[model samples]
Every structure is written in C-alpha cells, then in structure tokens.
Target: MRSDSMGRQLLPKRIALPIFASDALSSVAYAPDEILLTLALAGSLAALNSVWVGVAVAAVLAVVVISYRQTVHAYPSGGGDYEVVSTNLGKTWGLVVASALLVDYILTVAVSVSSGAAYITTALPSLAGHEAIIAVTLIVILATLNLRGTREAGGAFAIPTYLYMGAIALMVVVGVIEWVTGNLGAAPTAHYDLVATGGHEEGLVGLAGAFLLMRAFSSGCAALTGVEAISNGVPMLRRPKSRNAATTLALLGTIAATMMLSVLVLARQTGVKIVENPASQLTLNGQPAPADLQIAPAISQIASAVFGAGSVFFFIITAVTGLILVLAANTAFNGFPTLASVLSRDAFLPRQMYRRGDRLSYSNGIIVLSAAAIVLVLGFNAQVSRLIQLYVVGVFISFTLSQLGMIRHWNRILRTRQSGEQRGRVLRSRAVNVIGFMMTGLVLIIVFITKFAHGAWITLVMILVVFLIQQGIHRHYETIRSQLRVDDWTAKRTLPTRVRALILVSNFSRPSMRAVAVARASQPSAIELVSVVADETEERRIRSEWEESGIPIRLTLLSSPYRNVIQVILQYVRTRRKRSPSEMLVIYMPQFLVRHWWENALHNQMALRLRRALLGVPGVVITVVPWKLGEDAEVEGHQLVNDPFKRPTTIPSPSSDTLVGPETVEE
Candidate 1:
C-alpha cells in the first residue's frame, strides 16, 4: 500500500543469489536425513549405499540446473516453468505446472521450517515438545521479514546464508581432515546395531534390494527440491536478469550438490545409523534402544562426530545449519510472489497479488504463502518426517513438466531459426533439457511409486485443486472479455438529452447548502432537492427556512412512513429511471469527509446506502460532493463549484441558474 517503484524492487546478483538460492543450499540440512532414513529401512547394507543415492540425486541436480539456466536465458519474463509450459504446451499444462510449482513452494516453507525445528530440538531437549509451535513462529518471522521487501529480506538473510555455507564447508573440511588423519570416530549412534525390518535382517536381495535402492534414490531426490526457485524469480534480478539468474542457478547447483554429496558420504563414513522405528530397529550394546530416545538428525550426528560433540565449531555449524533451514523458506517467500504476479498478469490469480507493496514487495502473496505454510505445519504437527513424504513430490512434478516444456520451447525456436550458430545453440539447449526431463521424469515416477500412499497423494490432490481453481479464473476472465468486447468503433454510448440533478437534503447545514450550489453550477435543465421526511418537525424546519431563503431549486418530498430512507430513495430512483431511461439521472449525494477512519462510521451511513441501492437504476449517476469537517469546509465547497476539473463539462452551461448565497458564485 505504498509506492510500487520498479527500481527499488530490482535485486543485484549478490542479494538475489541468497534470495533464490537459500532453499537449495538449505536442503543439505535435511536431504541427508531423508536419504539415511529411507536406506536404513533395509538395514546397514542399504545404508552403505546412501552415498551412491546422493551421487545419483546430484547428477539429476546437475542436469536440472543446466536445463534451467537455458530456461532463464530463453524466457526472461519471470514466469519460469509456468511461462514455458504455457507458451509451448498450452494453457492447461501451463496451469498444471503453475499448480505444481505453487504447491511446491508452500511445501518448501513447511518442510524447511519443520526440519529446522527438528535441529533445534536436537540441540535443546527442553524444546522438543513444542516443535509445531516453534515451526509456525519461524514461518511468521519469515513472512514479516519478507514483507519488508526482497532486497531488504535478502540483505537480512544473506549473512546467515553465507555463514551456513561456510559452516557446512568447514564441517566438510574438518570431517575430511579427521577422516584422513585417523582422528574421526563413529557417530554417537554408530555403535547401535541396525536390525532389518519386515524380516530382511539377513540383507537386501533380488528385486526387493533393487526396489529399496530405488526408494532411497527417490528420497535423496529431496536435495533437488529448491533448484527451480532461481529460475522462477528471474525478474527480481538486476539488469541482465536472465544472465544473473542463470549464474545464480549454477552457483546453487555447485554448492548444493557439493554439500549434499559430502554430507552423505561423511554421514556414511561416520557410521551414522538411522531407522524409522528407532526403538524396534536399533539396539545399543546388545539391548533394544529406549523407546522414547530422540534420534538427532543425520546432519547433527555428523557434525557432532566430525567436530567432536560440544565443541564450539560443532555448535556453530549446528546453529547456522538450523538457521539456514528456517531461511530456506525464504526462497519460497521470494518465489511464490514472483510466480503469483505472473499468474495474476495472465489472469490466473487475484489482481491484488500482482501489486507490489510500499516496500516494493508482493506483500499479498507473501501473506498468503505464510498462511498456507502455517496450515501445513499445524496439520502435520511440525513433524519433519511426515512433511518430507509430501515434500519432493510437488517439486518433482514441476521439474518433470517444466523440463518437457523447455524442450518444446527450444524445438519451436529451432524450427523458426534455421542455418546459423543460433541453430547450434538451440540444439544444445534442447539436448540439455532432454536429459533433464528424462532424469526428472524417472525420479517423479519413482517418487510416485514409492511414496504415493505415504502422503504424496495429498500433494497430488492439492495440485489438482489449484489447477482447477486457476482454470476457473481463466474461464471467468475470458467470459468477461467476451462480454465487454466492442465490435464497432462508431457504436454510441448513451448520454442524457436533458440533465436531472436530484440533490439529497439530509439537513439544513452548510454541507447541504454546498451540494445545492454545485448542482446549480452543473446547469441541469431540471434540478430538485429531494428528501425523505422521517420526522414532520425536521421537515417543517427545512420548509420554513427554504421559503425564508428563497432558494430557486424546487424541493420534492417523499414520505417515509417506516423511517426507511434507503428504500424511499430507491423507489424514487426506480420511478425516475422508468420515466426517463434515456436521460442522465444525476443523484448528488453530499457527504462530509472526516480525517480519521473511525469518523467515517459516524457519518455517510445513509449516503452510502443510497449510492448502493440507486446503482440498480439505469441512467442514474451518484456524485459524492464531500465537505471536509475541519479548516474551511465551506471554502473547499465553493472551490468544488468553480473548479473546472470538478464540474462535468456537459453539465456546465452559459445560462445556468445562479445560487443566491455568499459561498455560491457565478462561474
């Protein structure tokens, strides 16, 4: 609700990187947990392959990042996946991509904050019981900060993001050093024996082992969750927006891939053991682990073992990693607004979402994103594991469709541009997108097959609902356009042959007098002071003054037996409209403008209702002549009468009837 200046909203690369890259970078905090948790289902042998799954996921990340870099260059308008699919695949698939990305952004906020809360409870046992509350609090903080503007939020969040990257890098370095120098030891739970569940204790075998590997691979694909955020937010970047965004995407890919793979390998090297049912699947010192024992996340356990538990370096990594996870949702804060703005421009979202706030941010979209994320947090009770099941499905859906759309886009371009280096570039870009689509499509199917019943179905349903809603909005807009279209330029718009100005006289005050003066200046052929006589005493006082003052305009009285001013005015308007539907019926509704918002409630109740009810009458125009309550309402009233801009040109005539009063003047 402030200045929506464009310059203030443009983000330089330094700030934009953090704005869009936070989610991808923060995935290192929890992606490992998911990978380890899923692999641990089949015991240690499957767990040993965690690093391999991470490698496969990182490869997909590489292809996706490359594909999206091409995307930003090709379509710099910030619609990202939605634009690509809509341009090449048609509006329906475009809506599907938008719906998937929209759902993905919401889940990113929920899953990131939930994972952050898990890290908090890991370091501080006292806060374990309030995870959902803590997660929602984090969402509120993020929404508030983001509403301040993208550049400001990026500035505020940049430090922690840098610190998190540094911390993770340091952890990896310290971990490798400890591993090389023979100083690293097993994690706190490394000694706990991991027992295979569902009678697979002997070890993974045959088709079942292959399926377990596939499931772990799908789980690890969570690392790719936030990779598309940079592409979705190209317009937010400074000049050369697409180039800067593509570079940021590359930076994100390198950092996220490096961190995810290193952390997984280190977690595996530290002999970190994780099981979904820790009490039943894990045994410590030859006895079943305590049923209520809290298992720290894989990142936490790795940090502890590598840096030595309780050390300053270890605590710093733990704190910043958690901070990064909370800030990871910042990516969605930037993404959803930009994407929603595009949707709004395309008539798929509310016009309000297209508006930038005084802070030059999409405040409405931010507020809505926060509300939805909070609902998810509350619905899942802030449990990271539960939310994770619903997490990557949306992103993968978007990834699969967006890449396919990009391929179509490049092919369409290749056909248009033949014989040159441009053709070569197009072919290369298409190849990258092809690889990206195939990789992501495979992961999407794997995720669907492995996690569908576990909660991915919920995300699928959500995407369908959003898709339908967007389609409805598009249809509604199309209908409005069809209804409003003009077929001929010479078509006539109706105008009154003779003006009839009805000045509503609520009381004999200066404000009412001003209304009569302006109406007379408008030079209507037929002008009358209309009033509903609620009380005979009030009516008598007005008529006595009317005769004494000798006001030239005729007064028309309507009897309101039920004291219902609005109904009486509506009846009069209806009758007048029926008598002269082709003529302009100008209803001069005078009002007093008060300074404060609450003062509005004190006045204008009748005038407001009169305006609303009379709108149904064809050819009726309600003109509000407002008198400011303080500091010369009468002077401004005369100004309203004489100001050329205030009085309609068609109404002003050379031989208009003059109002005989000190404030009324001949113009």
Candidate 2:
C-alpha cells in the first residue's frame, strides 16, 4: 500500500558484485560444458579446439561487459536496456528489447534451476527422473526467499557466490601447480574414446570447418548471457551508483572470463572428453563404457583431476559449484521484478506487478516469473541442452537493441556539448556503443543461424507473444483512460433534486422496521414500504403486520406471477427513472449482518443482482440497511469494523440539534 521504500539506497561495490554479477559468474560452471558439447558433434579432436572457442567467447564477454559499463554510467536511473533502446531508438524498439529481456530472465530461472537439479541428481543418484519436481521445489524456495525482500535474498546469495569464486580459484591454482610440477593427471573419462554423432564428424575441412567454428562460438556465447544483468541492477548499487555498478560489472567480467578460460584450458590439458550420451558415445578399449559410469560435470572433472578422486577439496568444489548455479537464478529474481516494475509503470504490463509485498519486494512479479520458469522446465523435462538452445538468443536480442540505443543516447548528448571532458567521455562512450552494436548484432545473427532450428525459434515466438501482450495491455489501459475521463459535462452534472425512498419489506420484521426508520430520517420527498406478493399467504401476513404497526409510511404490494423479486423491483425502478429522470429513487433493502463466515450462505443472493441492476438505471441509488443480529453485534465489538454500512454515521439529521454519538451507530 505504501510507495515502495525508495529510501533504500544502492548497493556498494563489494555487495554489488555478487548481487548483480552472480548470474554471469556462475555461468563458468556450465559455459565450458556447452562449448565442449557443441564441438563434440565434430568428434573429440574438434572438441580439442574448445579452449580457443572459450577464449573467443571470453573476449566477446569482455567487450559486452565494457559496453554495458558505459551504458550504466550514461543512464544510471536503471531502466537498463529498455531505457537505452527507448531513448536512442524509439518506443517500439525499446519495447522489443524489454520483451526479449523479460523472456530471457524467465529462461534464466528455468535453465539455472534445471541445471542445478541435474547436478543434485548427479550427487544423489536416488533423485533421478524426479528432476522436474526438484527443479520446481527449488524455484518455490527461491521465490519464497525473494518474497522476503531483495536485501535478504541478496544476502542469501552472497556466501554461495563467494564460495563458488573461492572454490574455482582454488581449483585453478591447484591445476596450475600440478601442471607446472608435471603431476596433473587425466580425468576419469579421459581414457574413454568419444564417438561423435551428426554430420559434424565429416572432415570436409574448409567452409564447413569455418561453419563448425561459428557453431562452437555460438554455443560458447552462453557465457555472455548474464553480462547485461549488472546494468539492469544499477539502481540497486550504492551512492555513485554508476561507478559502483561499472566496477561490479568489470569484476564480474574479469573473474568470469578467467574462470571460464581456465576451466576450458584445464579440461583440454587433462584430455577430458565429454559426450552427449556418455554411456553410449563413450568407448573404453574399443568397447562401450559402463552404463553406470557417471560423467562428472566439466568443472567436477577438473576438480577431481587436480585434487585427486574422493578428496575433500574435490567435494567442496563440486558442492559449491552446484550451490552457486542454484543461486545464479537469484540474479533473474532481482532483475525480472525490477524490470517488470518499470514496465508496469509504463503501462506495458499489469499494474499489480508494481505493488510490493509486506517485505517491500515485488512479490507478484516473483511469483509470476517462478511460475513461468516452472512451466518451461516441465515442458522441456529439465534438459539443460535443449534449454540452452532457447537461451542466448533473447540476451543477444536485448544486447543489440540496447547498444544501438546507447549510441543514440550519446549522440544526443554530443550535439549539445562543447570540447570538454564531458564531450570526450561522450565520444568515447559512443565508440564503445558502436562497437557493441556491431558485435552483438553479428552474434545475434550467428545465434539465430546456428540455433534457430534447435529450439531458439521457440524463444523468438515467445518474445513476440510477450511484445503483443504488452501492446495489448497498453491499449487496454488507454481505452480505460478514455472511458473514465472527466469532461465539463461530468464535472458540472448536479445530483438529483429530490429523493423518493422505498423500504423493501418482507413480513414486517425488525429488519424491515429499522429500514423504514433510517429511510424516514433522510427526509425523502415521498417514502413507501413495498412488498412483493409472490404468494398470497405470505403477502397477507406481511400486510397484517404492517397494519398492526400502523407506520406512517404507506405500504403497497406488487404482485409477481413469476416469483422474481429482482425483476419486479428492477422493472419498477426503470419505470420510475423514465417518468422522472431528474429525481433520485433510494431503495432501502433490509439486510442482516452475520458474524460467522458461513452465515453469508443463509442470505439470498438477490441483493447483489439488485445492486448491479440499479447501477445501470440513472438517478437511482441502492442503500443496504444492515440490521445486525445479536451475535453479529457482539462479534463486531471484538473485531475491527471494515463494512461500509456498519461504519459510524457521520451525516447530521435536521431533527438533531447536536451531533450523534459514535456509540449510537455501534449496533
């Protein structure tokens, strides 16, 4: 209900790194595998080139990180790519990037959780085939953690991120020491021969080889998936938000590139051979490898080779890598809701997403993202390889649009600037943006060519659908705004000059009597008690009771042959409005306020229908005169009063010289 706590400051550099960079940093755990997996299509010798591919990917990642650093510094209000594209290009381009980023953030959660589940299943064999269940459970847990608020979720991720970094650094150091001492050993799978599938194994070696290399490069681009996340999170950074976010982005790029390159190098040096189906594709001494021979992850293999099998350090590295991959989705958690909030404010999404929960986080957005990711995980059976195909495309789509946007952003600034430091900065940033636009656009093209058939098209379709939905939402809000506009006619319209009150009576009970009393106090020009004669016996008893009370208001009966109370009253109100559209008809319906929840079932649903019908008739008002039962009155004394009818009466009556006491309305 409160405006989101803007008093919350940005993240400092130390905290910002883990908060914004965890996704990219954690990709080192999987990027090596992806590179090797893609090249393995061409056979083991082709995968031997994976180290070079990793380096190329690392270079691209460095360029992107640097480009985004400039982006963050230039537009630190934290619209991220959407802001960049919208400002530089146009609103439509900005919307496209926003939609792409939204889709990517969702895939990030699904892929990260599924990958984490795979690692867990590898660690615990009994959990096999339950991957979807485990993945969804992890998502739910993460959603709950995020719902608790951003700071707590960030704190939860901090340790795992640092632990992952420490473990990878230790592995790298140990691997280097072993290599220098000539003691580095081959991985357990190194002795197995890898049988390549697909036409990639054909040694045509010319343009075909170049295409294969492009494919490998495209696969390795997975490392760059989370690079832009830091820029999206600039608002979460501390004072000097731009500077802190840039530093965090730099640290993220350096560490991630180092870890990924080292893993690839170590895998190559150790003669590691990873296959799609290890049990069938791997051969030992010209025979198929054992079916139960678990193929450890690329990082796990490197860890074991450096630290020796079954060592504590090996287990530590394995556990930490899995933990960090699971927490990697936390980056999406932070980015998705913030971006959703921005979109919602722009009317491109449901405004509910902008409402924060008790913990001051966008709880609705978190739940929505988690639900979407779970659907993808279940639909794809939590297979990381297939999900990986659907990745990179969205990230690169955003990347291309954002860079182009930044170029435009800088040009606008340049036009107004003179030969000063600001001008130099703008020119330098423009150069970075230009380079980024070309590089990202080319990679996007490669990704589409290499992966579109492999399920990347699914992501594109999803982005289009999201874009259309956003456009629809914007149109819907626009339509509603047009409908609700207040013009001179609306402002100058006068309330009805007179009130004609009617008390709906049945059997002349205490409720009906109270309705009449409240209606008379309003000083209506004409007051009457109306009852429906659905049955002769009931109508006779009501008339007898009314005559016995001898009330001042006249009692009248309307015969209903079809026994329809709502229809009869609605027809009468319509006739009255037709006769005197300028006069207000106040229908006082006697109702009982009950104490227990189930007691609501005891009442007729006719009141709801009557209220809806009356709203459409001009100059007609429906007031519910609630007669509290004894138990309801007692319960009301104990509970907070939120019911509109039961609120303390504020309007003064002409007969009362003094104000009514609050206690008078308590019953």
Candidate 3:
C-alpha cells in the first residue's frame, strides 16, 4: 500500500509515548540487575546499597529530563543535540554529537535485544544457547514493524508499552504492600551470602572501596539510555510538538525513576541478589550451588516474592517485561532514523536518509540500524552482561555534549533578547542545562574510568569511526558543491555549439525505431547506426531485418573479436571523434524496458554497458531510447522516413582550437 503524507504520519502523544518511551521504561527490566550485580562485587553491604545508587542515578535523570524539556521547547525542529550543537557551538561539534548518538542508538538496540533474549531464556530454560538467534530474529521483527511507518509502528507497540507500565507499577505497589504487611517473604537466594573476592572481602570502606561504588553508579546509569529520544523525535509529534514531546520526556523520567526506585526497594526488601558470575560467585546451603542453577533476574525475583512464583501476576510481569525490552529497540528504530534524516539534511549522511519509504518511515535508516544491531548481536554472542559495558558511554557522551550545547544556546539567545520575559526563560534554561552538563560530565568520566577496561573503549572507538565517516560524507558534499558553484560565469560556463546523434542497434526493434524517430524529430546534424559484430551469421541476420524495415540510416559495423560490445563501441566513438573533432557527439542507444526485476537478468543488456563506456569520452553524450515490450517496431521507423523535410542539415562545427583553453584564459 502507498503511504500517507507527512501530516498524516504525525503521532499524538499517546502513540509517541510507546514509540519513544519504551526504551526508558524497558530499562527497568535490566537496570536493576546491573546495579545489583556491580555492587555485589563489593560484598553484601555494598550490594545492599542498590537503592542509594539508584537514587543517585535518578537525581541525574531528573536534571537531564528537565534539560531536554527545555531543549524541545527551545528548538522544536527535531534535530535534537545535533541541531543544538550545530547552532550554538559549530557544525563540527554537531557532528560529534550526531556520531555519538548514532553509536548509542545502535547500542541501545543491541543491548535491549540481548537483554530481551536473556529474559526469554530466563522464562524458558530449554531455549538456552539460542539467545543470539532469537535476538537477531527479534531485531528483524522490530525492523519490519518500524518500516510500516511511524504511527503504525507506534500503535502496534502502544499496548505492550502501556501494559509494561501498568504491570511494573502494579508489581511495585503490590510488592511494597506485601513487604509492609509481612506477607512477602525473602527471595529464594536472600539467605545466600555474596562471597566477595579481589580485595573486597572487608566490605566497602576507604578509597579502594569507593571506586567500586562509582563503578556501580556508572552501571546503574544505564537506566538513562533512552531519555533523549523524545527530544530527537520532536518533529514527529502532533500539533504543539514541542509541548507534547516535553510532556513525554517528563513522564518518561518520572515513570522510569519511580520504577527504578520501586524495583530497587522491592529487591532490597525481598533480599534479591544478582551477581555478575553465577557459576563461581554464588553459593547455596553453605556451599557452592549447582553450576547450572538458574538465578532469576532481580525483577523476576521481586515479582515472584510479591506474587507467588508461577502465579498469573508473575507470568504477566515476566511476559510484558520481556516484550517491553524487545520493544525498547523500537525506540531506537524511531529515533535513529529521525536523527539520521536531520544529518542527511545537513549533508553529514547519505541523501537516502532524507527520503521516507513507502510507509513514510525512514526505511533505509531502519534497515541500516537493524543490520548494525544484528552485527552486534552476532559479534557479542547476545550476552547482555557483556554487551552492557559498551552501552552508556556514547549516550553519556551525547548527554554531556548536548547539555553543553543547550547551555551555549541559551546564552546566545539571552544576549540577543537583552531585557524581556524571554531573557528570564533563557537564563532559567541555561541553569538547567548547566546542571545537566556538569552531572553528565561526571558520569561520563566515571563511565570511562570504570568501564574502559571492561568495554566502554569499544564504544569510544565506534563514535570515532562514525565521526570520521560523517566527516568523509561532509567533505564529499562540500567537494560536489564547490564543483557545481560558478566561480567565473563567462570563463567557466562552456556552451556546446553543435549536436549530432549516433544510435546503436542490434536489430530494427521497436526500441530502435523509437530512438530513430526521436533523434530525427530533434533534427540533429547527422545520423548513423552503430552495431558491434560478434560473428557474420549473427550480423547477417540483423542486416536482413534492417533492410526489411526500409530505414534511411547507414549501418556501420565495428569489429569485436573478444565479443565485448562495450569495447567495440568505445573504440569506434574515439575514432569518429578523431575524424570530426568539432561537434558535440550524442550517443543514443535503444533499450527494452522490462516489467519484472528478474527479467533484467534474462535480457542481454548491451546498450546499458555501452552507455557507461561512452560516458568517459570527451565531447560525447549518452541517451537511453526505451521501447516497451510487445510494440510495433516498424511504425516509428517508417514515420521518420516519410517526413518530407526531415533532412539531415549540415552545421559548421567549431573546433577545440577556437575554444579558449584554461591555460590561455585570463584569470
């Protein structure tokens, strides 16, 4: 089906919430695991500090959310950080943020799909070892949904997203009430001590122990992964796009922070324990548990403790949690393409990104994002724990840069509007962005220092690679623009003085006749037909067909011992140019148009190849003469012969010696 227009594609906040907020909501599924796992390395007391670490993350989330709200209001063009940075700082910094966001969006899909797959294995133990395949398949499914346009994909994902929000909120409420009433008991592994190793046996204390806390904080910051999606996707929203986007950002932040804190509290109260290595680090019944013992995720444990294991509530939570995690990738699918579109508009990406596909979605960008996520899935073997280390670096980089850009943006505006109500808002916005930048800058440092050895360096490398690629694309566009610009109007503009047409033909087909009529109707200086001779028998058969057609043009045969039609045409064109070096030579070839893609391979497309070779010849041109299948061949050819005054006229073509050469022209 054909897609709707851009106006029809605009999404209301209700639909946009799922398309953009799913990533932030789904982080609750695994953000708790990261915090608990990272802290569990520092013994039980530090692991018990999960809530405190979450509070720290949530505080930063508040600042960032407020900052982005201001961003959407101030700049509603949907360029997000790239636009902010480009307008405030410079285009170079804009590219840096773009590159970082590109990497972060790809990582969001990779990490989200991987975690979703892990939840699948958690729910179905028999499906173990197939996580990567399941994850890739999920990516393909998400890609398909997104390619169907923005609103369609948003509607498809809305139910599960709202379900996830309700489920998580209910789980948190039920979990808290159960613990308060002493109805929910400790988790299955609540009594198992987290045996510490590598100098963390004495619990968190002193500088050595403080670094572990920072590591956990940095890991917990994964909760903030998709916080900027709303800002990037402001253009896709309905009327009052900025206000709706800002409201969505605020709602995302509030829900996410609440869920994170709720999950953290429930985990703590139910004595849920998550560790990085279940094989060696975990113990049961005062001894090492079975190596194959399935450690339920923190959320799953909380769900189980709140509503008895295998209960309908627990299964519902588990099911929707997995769904939201997979749907989280949909956020990237929506945001990445929009951001890629902005980059394309600025000439930092391919022009393909600027066009919407049949469904009014950025289908090329979606395909490219899916391909990158699949590569990452296969590369990292679909291990969420492993892939997560490479997750937040790029996002925090974007966060820091985006905040800095917004601050600069406000300052620039404030200077322009010296004394007005607008200046007050600009100053307030600058304060928000300032706080956001400082906080995110600290997190970036923590992420780099704590996770660099783990895997964050790989993300930095990716950002650099993407940045360089964007720079390359920018340079290419700049070169093309420079070449197109008229430097010296009189000296630079070279006008063609004469025109001649050469029609290449294999047989007197309809395509050939159409080309002959067009060339004659245009009335070129002269006309000639070119054919490459592979063998006498084949050439004789063509000659017999041409004589029967009764066309006036003389046929010239070029030798092709190698049976290379392109080579024969190029040699003949070069020889003709040498003989008549004045006229602007036009090479026209007849082509049969096929209705099906597979029909292309079935046909021998010699004229197509001949066009490419003849393009390089100086003072020459190429034209396609397409003829439809099942059309009369002789009608147009005979029409051209019958036109009384359609005689080939002679024109005095000027030689290149009369043309001013660059070396002889005045600068």
Per-candidate TM-score against the hidden true structure: 0.87, 0.88, 0.88
Runs in model 1 lying further than 4 Å from the true structure: 1-14, 197-212, 238-241, 414-417, 420-425, 479-494, 533-554, 559-564, 593-596, 599-604, 616-618, 630-667
Q: Provide the overall lDDT of each model, using Cα atoms, as 2-decimal numbers.
A: 0.83, 0.81, 0.84
lDDT string for model 1 (1-667, tens) is 3464677778888788777888888888888888888878788787888888888989999999998888888889888888888888898888898999999999999999998998888888899889999999999999999888787788999999999888889889989999999998789889888878885554558777777778778878888877888877887788888889888988989999999999988998898877778788898787999898777777778888987889898889888989999999999998899899999998998889998887888999999999999999999999888888888888887888988898888877877948788898788888998988898999999999988988999999999999988888888988998978987656556445887888888665766877877777777777777777756686677677666656666667677767888888788788878888777788887887777988777765777777778777766788888777774644563564534234445554422433332121011
Worst 10 residues of 2 by lDDT: 658-667
Q: Write the residue-wise lDDT of candidate 3 on 1-667 in tens digits.
A: 3544788888998898888989998998998899999888877888888999999999999999999898898889988888888888898888888999999999999999998998988899899999999999999999998888788888899999999999988988887788788898778778787878688876678776788889889988999989888888998999889999999998899999999999999899999988766656777677876677778888889888888888999899898999999999999998899999999998999999999898888999999999999999999999999999999998898899999888877777776837777778677778888899999999999999999999989998999999999999989999999988997998756665566677887777667777776676665666666777677686677778766766566666666767877766777788878987877788888778777788999977766767777778887888886766654554344644334224435423223332221111011
What does candidate 2's lDDT look like per residue over 121-231, in tens digits?
Answer: 877889988988999999999999989877777778888899899999989998999998999988978898877665656632666667777877887888888788877
lDDT against true structure, model 2: 0.81
| Ranking of predictions according to TM-score | 3, 2, 1
RMSD of each: 5.3, 6.0, 5.6
Clashes of 3: 0
| Candidate 1 pairs with clashing backbones | none
In terms of TM-score, the best-performing candidate is 3
How does candidate 1 score on lDDT?
0.83
Q: Which candidate is the best by lDDT?
A: 3
